[model samples]
Target: MSTTSDLGTHGERIAAAYLTDRGLRVLDRNWRCREGELDIVAREGDALVFCEVKTRRAVGFGHPAEAVGHAKQRRLRTLAQRWLAAHDEHAPDLRFDVVAVLVRAGRPALVTHLRAAFS
Candidate 1:
Protein backbone atom coordinates (compact mmCIF):
# COMPACT_ATOMS: atom_id res chain seq x y z
CA MET A 1 0.00 0.00 0.00
CA SER A 2 1.19 3.48 -0.74
CA THR A 3 1.92 5.71 2.20
CA THR A 4 -0.08 8.90 2.80
CA SER A 5 2.84 11.07 1.76
CA ASP A 6 3.25 9.09 -1.42
CA LEU A 7 -0.41 9.50 -2.24
CA GLY A 8 -0.18 13.25 -1.67
CA THR A 9 2.89 13.60 -3.87
CA HIS A 10 1.21 11.64 -6.64
CA GLY A 11 -1.86 13.80 -6.37
CA GLU A 12 0.11 17.03 -6.50
CA ARG A 13 1.92 15.85 -9.62
CA ILE A 14 -1.37 15.00 -11.26
CA ALA A 15 -2.86 18.30 -10.21
CA ALA A 16 0.06 20.31 -11.56
CA ALA A 17 -0.11 18.59 -14.93
CA TYR A 18 -3.85 18.96 -15.04
CA LEU A 19 -3.57 22.69 -14.38
CA THR A 20 -0.90 23.22 -16.99
CA ASP A 21 -2.94 21.32 -19.54
CA ARG A 22 -5.81 23.67 -18.87
CA GLY A 23 -3.64 26.74 -19.50
CA LEU A 24 -2.56 27.57 -15.99
CA ARG A 25 1.15 28.26 -15.73
CA VAL A 26 2.62 26.55 -12.70
CA LEU A 27 4.78 28.99 -10.76
CA ASP A 28 5.50 27.04 -7.61
CA ARG A 29 4.75 23.79 -5.85
CA ASN A 30 4.61 23.16 -2.14
CA TRP A 31 5.34 26.74 -1.13
CA ARG A 32 5.73 27.03 2.63
CA CYS A 33 5.64 29.85 5.12
CA ARG A 34 5.33 30.20 8.86
CA GLU A 35 1.58 30.16 8.34
CA GLY A 36 1.28 26.96 6.28
CA GLU A 37 1.97 25.37 2.92
CA LEU A 38 0.34 26.16 -0.40
CA ASP A 39 0.16 23.00 -2.49
CA ILE A 40 0.41 24.61 -5.89
CA VAL A 41 0.89 28.26 -6.85
CA ALA A 42 -0.07 29.00 -10.41
CA ARG A 43 -0.83 31.77 -12.85
CA GLU A 44 -3.92 31.73 -15.03
CA GLY A 45 -3.99 34.74 -17.28
CA ASP A 46 -3.79 37.68 -14.92
CA ALA A 47 -4.76 35.69 -11.86
CA LEU A 48 -2.59 34.15 -9.22
CA VAL A 49 -3.99 30.90 -7.86
CA PHE A 50 -3.30 29.10 -4.64
CA CYS A 51 -4.31 25.47 -4.98
CA GLU A 52 -4.95 22.83 -2.38
CA VAL A 53 -4.60 19.20 -3.38
CA LYS A 54 -6.43 16.34 -1.69
CA THR A 55 -5.92 12.70 -2.61
CA ARG A 56 -7.86 9.62 -1.64
CA ARG A 57 -7.69 5.94 -2.45
CA ALA A 58 -11.45 5.65 -2.10
CA VAL A 59 -14.54 7.74 -1.37
CA GLY A 60 -15.27 5.85 1.83
CA PHE A 61 -14.94 9.01 3.87
CA GLY A 62 -16.23 11.56 1.40
CA HIS A 63 -15.26 13.49 -1.71
CA PRO A 64 -11.64 14.58 -1.48
CA ALA A 65 -12.54 18.22 -1.98
CA GLU A 66 -14.81 18.14 1.03
CA ALA A 67 -11.74 18.11 3.24
CA VAL A 68 -11.21 21.76 2.43
CA GLY A 69 -13.87 23.26 4.61
CA HIS A 70 -14.55 26.74 5.96
CA ALA A 71 -11.75 26.73 8.47
CA LYS A 72 -9.33 25.51 5.86
CA GLN A 73 -10.53 28.25 3.54
CA ARG A 74 -9.71 30.83 6.14
CA ARG A 75 -6.26 29.37 6.64
CA LEU A 76 -5.62 29.34 2.90
CA ARG A 77 -6.60 32.99 2.73
CA THR A 78 -4.15 33.80 5.47
CA LEU A 79 -1.44 31.90 3.69
CA ALA A 80 -2.14 33.73 0.46
CA GLN A 81 -1.78 37.02 2.21
CA ARG A 82 1.52 35.94 3.70
CA TRP A 83 2.72 34.76 0.31
CA LEU A 84 1.86 38.08 -1.25
CA ALA A 85 3.65 39.98 1.46
CA ALA A 86 6.82 37.98 0.85
CA HIS A 87 6.75 38.28 -2.92
CA ASP A 88 7.78 41.38 -4.86
CA GLU A 89 5.47 40.81 -7.79
CA HIS A 90 1.81 41.69 -8.00
CA ALA A 91 -1.23 39.90 -9.35
CA PRO A 92 -4.31 41.78 -10.48
CA ASP A 93 -6.45 38.79 -9.66
CA LEU A 94 -6.15 36.23 -6.86
CA ARG A 95 -8.06 33.01 -6.37
CA PHE A 96 -8.13 29.70 -4.59
CA ASP A 97 -8.49 26.26 -6.18
CA VAL A 98 -8.84 22.70 -5.05
CA VAL A 99 -7.62 19.61 -6.86
CA ALA A 100 -9.12 16.28 -5.89
CA VAL A 101 -7.44 13.03 -6.87
CA LEU A 102 -9.02 9.60 -6.74
CA VAL A 103 -6.41 6.89 -6.89
CA ARG A 104 -7.21 3.29 -7.71
CA ALA A 105 -4.82 0.46 -8.35
CA GLY A 106 -4.32 -0.60 -11.97
CA ARG A 107 -6.42 2.24 -13.24
CA PRO A 108 -5.72 5.76 -14.37
CA ALA A 109 -6.21 8.21 -11.55
CA LEU A 110 -9.18 10.53 -11.65
CA VAL A 111 -8.60 14.28 -11.19
CA THR A 112 -11.09 17.02 -10.41
CA HIS A 113 -10.19 20.69 -10.25
CA LEU A 114 -12.41 23.25 -8.58
CA ARG A 115 -11.41 26.71 -9.74
CA ALA A 116 -12.09 29.71 -7.54
CA ALA A 117 -13.32 27.22 -4.97
CA PHE A 118 -13.11 29.80 -2.25
CA SER A 119 -12.50 33.50 -1.80
Candidate 2:
Protein backbone atom coordinates (compact mmCIF):
# COMPACT_ATOMS: atom_id res chain seq x y z
CA MET A 1 0.00 0.00 0.00
CA SER A 2 1.02 3.58 -0.50
CA THR A 3 2.32 5.57 2.45
CA THR A 4 -0.86 7.56 2.80
CA SER A 5 -3.09 4.53 2.75
CA ASP A 6 -0.81 2.77 5.19
CA LEU A 7 -1.07 5.67 7.55
CA GLY A 8 -4.83 5.66 7.35
CA THR A 9 -5.05 1.95 8.04
CA HIS A 10 -2.68 2.31 10.93
CA GLY A 11 -4.73 5.12 12.30
CA GLU A 12 -7.88 3.07 12.15
CA ARG A 13 -6.27 0.18 13.92
CA ILE A 14 -4.97 2.41 16.63
CA ALA A 15 -8.29 4.08 17.01
CA ALA A 16 -9.97 0.72 17.28
CA ALA A 17 -7.57 -0.34 19.99
CA TYR A 18 -7.91 2.90 21.87
CA LEU A 19 -11.66 2.67 21.89
CA THR A 20 -11.65 -0.97 22.90
CA ASP A 21 -9.47 -0.08 25.82
CA ARG A 22 -12.04 2.49 26.79
CA GLY A 23 -14.63 -0.29 27.11
CA LEU A 24 -16.36 0.29 23.80
CA ARG A 25 -17.36 -2.78 21.87
CA VAL A 26 -16.68 -2.46 18.17
CA LEU A 27 -19.48 -3.59 15.89
CA ASP A 28 -17.56 -3.07 12.69
CA ARG A 29 -14.72 -1.38 10.93
CA ASN A 30 -14.79 0.12 7.49
CA TRP A 31 -18.55 -0.31 7.48
CA ARG A 32 -19.91 0.70 4.13
CA CYS A 33 -23.01 1.32 2.12
CA ARG A 34 -23.96 3.12 -1.14
CA GLU A 35 -24.00 6.37 0.77
CA GLY A 36 -20.39 6.22 2.00
CA GLU A 37 -17.96 4.67 4.49
CA LEU A 38 -17.68 4.58 8.25
CA ASP A 39 -14.17 4.05 9.50
CA ILE A 40 -15.26 2.67 12.82
CA VAL A 41 -18.56 1.51 14.32
CA ALA A 42 -18.72 0.88 18.02
CA ARG A 43 -21.06 0.84 20.99
CA GLU A 44 -20.46 3.08 23.96
CA GLY A 45 -22.97 2.52 26.72
CA ASP A 46 -26.31 2.26 24.92
CA ALA A 47 -25.52 4.55 22.00
CA LEU A 48 -24.05 3.66 18.66
CA VAL A 49 -20.96 5.51 17.55
CA PHE A 50 -19.98 6.19 13.98
CA CYS A 51 -16.38 7.25 13.85
CA GLU A 52 -14.34 8.93 11.16
CA VAL A 53 -10.60 8.46 11.43
CA LYS A 54 -8.24 10.93 9.81
CA THR A 55 -4.55 10.08 9.71
CA ARG A 56 -1.69 12.10 8.31
CA ARG A 57 2.04 11.64 8.29
CA ALA A 58 2.45 15.19 9.38
CA VAL A 59 0.04 18.05 9.72
CA GLY A 60 2.18 20.88 8.46
CA PHE A 61 -0.53 22.27 6.25
CA GLY A 62 -3.63 21.43 8.26
CA HIS A 63 -4.83 19.38 11.19
CA PRO A 64 -5.90 15.83 10.52
CA ALA A 65 -9.49 16.47 11.63
CA GLU A 66 -9.68 19.17 9.01
CA ALA A 67 -9.80 16.41 6.43
CA VAL A 68 -13.42 15.68 7.31
CA GLY A 69 -15.59 18.44 5.91
CA HIS A 70 -19.29 19.06 6.05
CA ALA A 71 -20.01 16.96 3.01
CA LYS A 72 -18.05 14.07 4.44
CA GLN A 73 -20.00 14.29 7.67
CA ARG A 74 -23.28 14.12 5.80
CA ARG A 75 -22.09 11.14 3.83
CA LEU A 76 -21.01 9.39 7.02
CA ARG A 77 -24.41 9.98 8.51
CA THR A 78 -26.11 8.49 5.48
CA LEU A 79 -23.76 5.52 5.53
CA ALA A 80 -24.46 4.97 9.23
CA GLN A 81 -28.15 4.77 8.50
CA ARG A 82 -27.55 2.23 5.78
CA TRP A 83 -25.29 0.20 8.03
CA LEU A 84 -27.87 0.11 10.79
CA ALA A 85 -30.51 -1.01 8.31
CA ALA A 86 -28.34 -3.74 6.86
CA HIS A 87 -27.48 -5.10 10.30
CA ASP A 88 -31.04 -4.86 11.59
CA GLU A 89 -29.81 -2.88 14.56
CA HIS A 90 -32.26 -1.06 16.75
CA ALA A 91 -32.58 2.68 16.21
CA PRO A 92 -30.65 3.71 19.26
CA ASP A 93 -28.95 7.03 19.87
CA LEU A 94 -26.45 7.86 17.15
CA ARG A 95 -23.35 9.98 17.32
CA PHE A 96 -20.54 11.07 15.05
CA ASP A 97 -16.99 11.02 16.38
CA VAL A 98 -13.58 11.71 14.94
CA VAL A 99 -10.20 10.17 15.70
CA ALA A 100 -7.34 12.22 14.43
CA VAL A 101 -3.86 10.76 14.33
CA LEU A 102 -0.63 12.59 13.65
CA VAL A 103 2.43 10.51 12.91
CA ARG A 104 5.86 12.07 12.92
CA ALA A 105 9.22 10.44 12.46
CA GLY A 106 10.67 9.09 15.68
CA ARG A 107 7.78 10.47 17.65
CA PRO A 108 4.95 8.95 19.63
CA ALA A 109 1.51 8.64 18.11
CA LEU A 110 -0.60 11.73 18.56
CA VAL A 111 -4.18 10.64 18.78
CA THR A 112 -7.16 12.76 19.59
CA HIS A 113 -10.77 11.68 19.97
CA LEU A 114 -13.49 14.25 19.54
CA ARG A 115 -16.95 13.08 20.54
CA ALA A 116 -20.02 14.54 18.88
CA ALA A 117 -17.84 15.69 16.03
CA PHE A 118 -20.85 16.12 13.82
CA SER A 119 -24.61 16.06 14.16
Top candidate on TM-score is 1
Please give, for residues 16-102, the per-residue lDDT of candidate 1 as tens digits: 999999999998899899888999999998899999999999999999999999999999999989888888757899999999999
Model 1 ranges with Cα > 4 A deviation: none
Model 2 residue 21 CA deviation (Å) reads 1.1
lDDT of 2 by residue, 1-119 (tens): 37777888998998999889999899999976666678999999878999999988877879999988998988887888788878966646889999998877788788899999989
TM-score of each: 0.96, 0.92
RMSD to true structure for each model, in Å: 1.0, 1.4
Each candidate's lDDT (Cα)? 0.92, 0.87
Clash counts for the predictions, in order: 0, 0
Off by over 4 Å in 2: none
